[model samples]
Target chain A: MSHRLRILSRIRKALDAPAMPSETARAEAVAERIAHPPQHWPLRSIQTADPEGAAQLTLIGRFKAQLARLGADVIEVGSVAEIPAALANYVAANVADDAAGLARIRMGSDAFLAALPWSSTSGLEIAAGMAEAADVIGVSRAIAGVAETGTLLLVSGAENPVTLGYLPETHIVVLETGAIVASYEEAMQSMLAATGGRMPRTVNLITGASRTGDIGGKIVMGAHGPRRVAVVLWSA
Target chain B: MTARTQFDADIDTALADAPLQRALADVPAGFVAGRRRAREELLEFEPLRRVARDIRDHALAHLDLYLEAFESNATKAGSRVHWAASGDDACRIVLDICRAAGARTITKSKSMVSEEIELRERLQDAEFDVVETDLGEYLVQIRNEKPSHIIAPAIHMRAEDVADVFRRQHGHLAPDRKLDTPEEMIAEARGILRDKFLSADVGITGANFLVAESGSAIIVTNEGNADLTMSLPKVHVILTSIDKVVPTFSDAWPLLRLLARSATGQAFTAYTTIVTGPRRPDDPDGPEQCHIILLDNGRTELLASEMRPVLRCIRCGACMNHCPVYCSIGGHAYNSVYPGPIGAALSPALAGAEQAAHLAEASTFCGRCEQVCPVEIPLVSVMRQWRSLALEQPRSRRARVMLHTWARLAQHPRIYRWCAGIAARSLKWLAGSGARIRRLPFLHAWTDYRDLAAPQGGTFQQQWAQREHKRAQRDRADVSAARARKSDSVP
Candidate 1:
């Protein structure tokens, strides 16, 4: 094993209070729990011929419809191949009305946008070169369709950065049917097993809109995250 | 800020607070009963706890790999990742992102980390119109106050108090609205926040968990506001501590079970949404941009210490509900956003022991917090660690000396016995005619409220020793007589 992985293994062992089963039984137990589980929304799993293609199409269709319902303009990109060109065009279109927005477009053009804000723009920079771009960014996680709770689990340092989840006003998550589990316990067990017993540092189990009942018990949605949520479902 | 902590002369002050005392009286019964019922109802609760604890421990131990994986995935998904080493850095990252976005109005969900960082004051200092959308947060925000509790931020305020605030602030819409019921109050607040949600240029939230497997920052709220916050704004920024990450969506189950049940006795909250990166191709009304700030304010340092187990806390609020001190003094007494057992340990560590020296001493060393913590954080031991630190100051020297003197006196049984006898005699004399004293100097605090009855003349050890001695004497006499009779028979 690699040194880092070995150290991780040692730590995992130290933290574990011997689960009553041997390794084989442990795996079997996990599989059993996954098969039949506790009270939660009904989960539907899908096996697709092309997972990426299916995910993209579902997300695009769902987001457009949801945004249209909320009375917002929509932009469509078929693939990562089209991101740069699309982003530039998108920036130019909104430039006249939003000067700061234009600067963001200019800033985002750095080799690495991380340094664009403070002007040390160097290393691993991906410039947005006159391509059609998006003002709002939405990322989809492997989604779960299990309960009335309509929850999603966003782990920090995963396919979507924590920033993308919260920085955008209108965030769209594309959820796969297979990601939904029967209960919270099932979710954790699956996560633990998948990462070879190492859990992610942060797991965001988001259910419903970003809201605050803070102002005198008022229920206001969109307090801090995307004010609207559109969940894209792939057929099982 | 108003209530004194355990180390302050405020121990007595907090004990004397009648309103706080009344509010706290229900904690032991309410939390204890609810927990007992919850456990009884769910047979798998213990297993669930074990699973959750294990999962969190595993994640924290191998945090780097998962964090790397999450960051890579997020970038590929088109979301920008900003790594913050401290609370200040985290806040700065968010502010910079918004400044770049030219965001004028920012709406927020209730985020405890933001509270830890004092994010609101900092953001307001920067001139952004930050509005708290959570009802509890809004109430406290309107009052220019800090949250009194974690789950119920404005837990200290009564319904009528909320009504009064609404009447003053939301007068335009609800001029004649009477906040008689929780439902009515909720309705009024709803009307006011809807407008703000629509107009917000940016939305910031704290994630309960950040899934590394898929690079998502997830939020769970009873009200659907978190969903809207995650979905509506053009810009979405998640401010979260690095510890919030888990490996994958599948691993979120066990902890989620514990979180909802422990927080408010629900099987599950109303909403749980997973957000990955910014909107992909063909997407409609999602944020055009998304940013995830992975904050590491003092956490990486904490990971190297004995204090690391504290990171496993899921923020379930079980410890708070069961804490006696918290019940009596409430959250404001701790003087930090986090209150109760967790706060007692966390505040001192997060904001320097000097700033929160009194917090650790506030405990009666009650084990209820540990007993109920879903994550099983050894809170009492952590509090003791803080106490050890607090004891290093000169002010604690007197207490240390007194304790040492008592320890020395307690070593010799004879001295202990003599002291006990003297104490018993003095108390008996003071209680002449079998009446308890109404008060005593230096002990008036205890005696004024309730009398300490006089003990029996002899101590338990003394009585037992006398009985043993008399039995030995009787045995000797009997043996001698029996030996004499045997001698006579032989002759």
Candidate 2:
């Protein structure tokens, strides 16, 4: 017998319970689970535990605090036009070493970010493609943000490739205050709404810059991914 | 290391190794304290644990349905799912994939199932250059050792040990180069792994959760190695077992919430990527071919057994992180691919209780493992079941005689009390001066490790009876006084 058949038969024999659910039935079961989740007590507890529950300013405050806590630099901008100045100012202040000479930037090809006024930025050559070794900065517009954990939910496609989130030395995330949600559940719901209830190829939920505590239980950031994650919170 | 079957000898070896003892100290100071602090931060930590446990149990109850759902959705997403009946089968499938990809170099993130199958050894034996990207796993790989802990693979090694390993193995580097600090070591490793990541043909990672709702595989990592592993390679193969599938994204939240808090006490891991399948046609990057090997190596039988509750394990390493015995002797002593409380319960289930049954007896029965377990696995109870199975095996004459004597004495209370009184008095007399007893008759196994507390007085039954006599006298006096008061009131 084939491996799949043999394994399935063994599972069946061992269970001795009943036949497994059919394919369409599996989808139906998922729909039912989502609609009437049996385990909502924890979610309820989370809701009751929160003091400033989903108040817009409170949610944005929590998101910014979490982002900073994860070692990501945050700057609230009044408009999308201010993003270039934010990027330029961050480069000017943080770029101390002259070892790399001029720093190049990589941004996602997503239309939302592509429409940004990048021509207003001076001295920084921004490229729209996958990050290269020389690309010191990466700016990608997060589709959504989780206020509970300060995580950016970036969907992978031709427009917003996932590597831009992990590659480059510094990642500058562009997220609007309205995009920030209260919890992962809210984050998932918004993504479902955006995708028309279809799943993306890859959903990257990056909380902080890369870090590792593997050696002697000591944490060292900038392990393999970007050394730093900067958030441009366009609040207006 | 001795053979994996010699768990007793392995324990003795681990106990004597001063370096391993020192290394084991970090776990309690790091993972234990971090989890405690993280729990304090969450007001509903305990309730969340209940939620996580129920989520896992519900997932396991409908595992067959979820697995089928995952297979169908994953297939529809342009990924191939293969079934492996055993470890060898899984290895064969991987090797075949490498051959198909013409892969010379393989980059891997931390995967315990891959360790269980000894994937590295199998790959190297087939002449594939394999690199473990996780710093801890990489250190263990170069040192020719298995992971001592599930999450922190090289927790057994000190910084100095890693420095020595890098010096010896990284032969291409200048001999005089500084390799002292963990920072320096990380830099060196990062530089070395960067080239390998770019050049590797296949990237293999383990799924923390397989979302059946969207046919996505969830992998949470701190160092972003899994990200690079999947991102850089042309082909990505997920090495996961049959039990990892959850019904949907919502069902996976509670587990994810507890996972980081329980593992390293982080609010969230640095990276939590959900890959549905291979990259889309319009995607700028990601593997071209994505294959998921769902290995059912003894898991189906486990799922079908009374021990099915253990299938809810999320491999968070929380059980071992808080295990006192594990903190003392470390993970290598268990002699199975897994180690610690869950290891004691799970090894037997996966490797047959008959051969690996010794693992269950390695615990102190402290119940800390169960208390800290996010999935709320009754680890102590599972260990007891394994002990019962082990007892059914043939035992030495001394063990059989001792057990029989204890059972007989326990059955006859009068005789047991008489013998216990004499024994207690004698032990008290032996104790004599000071408090502790260096030598004892029945507790040789214990005194070898720590000083045994000498008996203070009579047997527990004798003390209880004396207390009862005093209580009875007090009761009679109270009743007489109440009767006198009643007569006075009547007059």
Candidate 3:
């Protein structure tokens, strides 16, 4: 056969793959707070929380390993109170008397609450009130895999703002080991089933950074959003 | 500063530039390296090329479907879609939009379609401040020049040349400044453009891929200017050819794969922002109004011709980057906005054969463009087609007569041989002793670098035939001996 014919045949095959499941089922699978995707809500909760203390320590170690692989500069603070100190030291060392860098960081991060001069009780509400707060706040969603691209899906509930995934540069995703899904199609099916085929108001499946090559064929990363991507995978 | 539309004379002048020749010479070495790197890194590179080719072919086949889908989707998303059947129509549409928006200052990203329609002149005629945002484009724009290389608009410019231009243009602003380095120059441009980005009323950009499925126009850029251009401006206008539209995102993926690698050997663009529509009500930053001008401009007509394969071009500039002729003359030598191999084919299609006749003659027909074309556009063939078209014009009476005289004389072998013999004798006599002529009126360009070697006493064809006659006698003797041996053996 000719080269064109052979290529057309391959495309036909890719398009003709059997329908896996309903879109609702895939969406539900993606939205669930499992360690991975596809386990029932009750069963996933069991895996997300260690039955004993043994698995909890093991999962913490795994989270640290993933962080190292992602090449993020890690700082382990004892509590939320110490987070301000950690961030200040980071800002001082990296950025030297630059308001622009400070502004960028403030715009990028979701957890910029403790450092601001708000009253002790006011906390995150003040950071959220900032005009140019992060573009998206990413939350961890246990989805199978993306149906089209192999993107990690995150759904927003009441605690998790939808903007976390899209707005913020630093995606402080608290992912448990049980939340990994196989494919996007399967994740979509689960998501659909859980939501009764009604997709979220804002669903973000992030693969990489916000990039464009519009200027003289040069690809500049982080145009509107955070150029820096930091993922915080932790035990449930 | 303005670029001339009458490119024929300007191109002839640029064809003589020395620095342009130097720049062209460097094209092959870098292009080979970049393409090889991309191929090695992306295992799916070839597959993506095939997929992209198929997608483009499919789209071209069913273009009406996708065009309708794109129009409706863009319209539904609150973007006004305008149809332009010609380059003039496209320019008129953009000018009308600018006039209506009260756009005194317009910042434009690199759009080949805009260049195709000579948009800057049109906009300037209407008295609008049009600034080119792309660095290479900015350099070319400031100098009142057209792009020489499609990808690197200022590829032919030397650092010293650029420094001089900058000094002349920006000396008053930083009169005491001593600028020497490229970094300094870049910083200066960045500082100047920072205010331009914010103050612009309208932004015009080019689309890499127009996704019909979601009514999104994808612009791939390395600089953050596109985002600023789109977000800061009240009115965002996209000038794109009809061929840019694709069926869906799935189809877009393969083309994107080939485009980056073929253009600059990047795995992916730094920013591949997909603008779906005008900013939503709650959205903080984005254009209030979006308009996508779908410029046909003889593309549909080209699609109906033998040169239809030329539309498969993703504008990667690989062909130009790899082209020997393009490297030497630079883009200005071609005199048309689109230069290099793809330009050689396309300019004639968009512009009339009469206007762009000289462009087709710019190519060496070396087939480098075709070899490096990711979508496999038969660039050389298209160029040859243009050559034939030019030849058949019937207007060039002198040229036609000359060709006719040569053709009529060339038919009779005896006459042609006699003419060749006389010409050879004269040429041999002209060379004092060494087979070199320092200067000859008609042959000056040909003999500039190297001398034409004198032919032997006889033509190769005649010499070969004589040798064969002698060899046939020897062969006959051998055949007789072999036949005698065979007869003895049979007995």
Q: In terms of TM-score, which candidate is stronger, 2 or 3?
A: 2
Per-residue accuracy of model 3 over B396-460 as CA lDDT, tens digit each: 56666889889987898888888877877777777758666666558686676446776566666
DockQ of each: 0.07, 0.58, 0.06
Better of 1 and 2 by DockQ: 2
Worst 10 residues of 2 chain B by lDDT: B1-10
Candidate 3 per-residue lDDT over residues A130-165, each given as its tens digit: 223323333233332221222345533333343343
lDDT of 1: 0.63
How would you class the docking of model 2?
A: medium
lDDT of each: 0.63, 0.84, 0.62
lDDT string for model 1 (B1-491, tens) is: 32233434555565677755665565555545666665654556766676777778767766666676678777766778887766787788888988988988888988999998888888999999999887788888998888877887886676677788878887676476566876577767665666677778888888899877667776777665665565567888888877888776656756776787787655455466567776655443457788887776556655656777788988988888888777767787677768888888777767777777458777888798888788888999988987888766555566678878789888987898888888777777778877676666676766843687766657767788899999999999999999999999995
Better of 1 and 2 by TM-score: 2
Kindly report the fnat of each predicted structure, to 2 decimals.
0.12, 0.70, 0.04
Among these predicted structures, which one has the highest DockQ? Answer: 2
Q: lDDT: which candidate is best?
A: 2
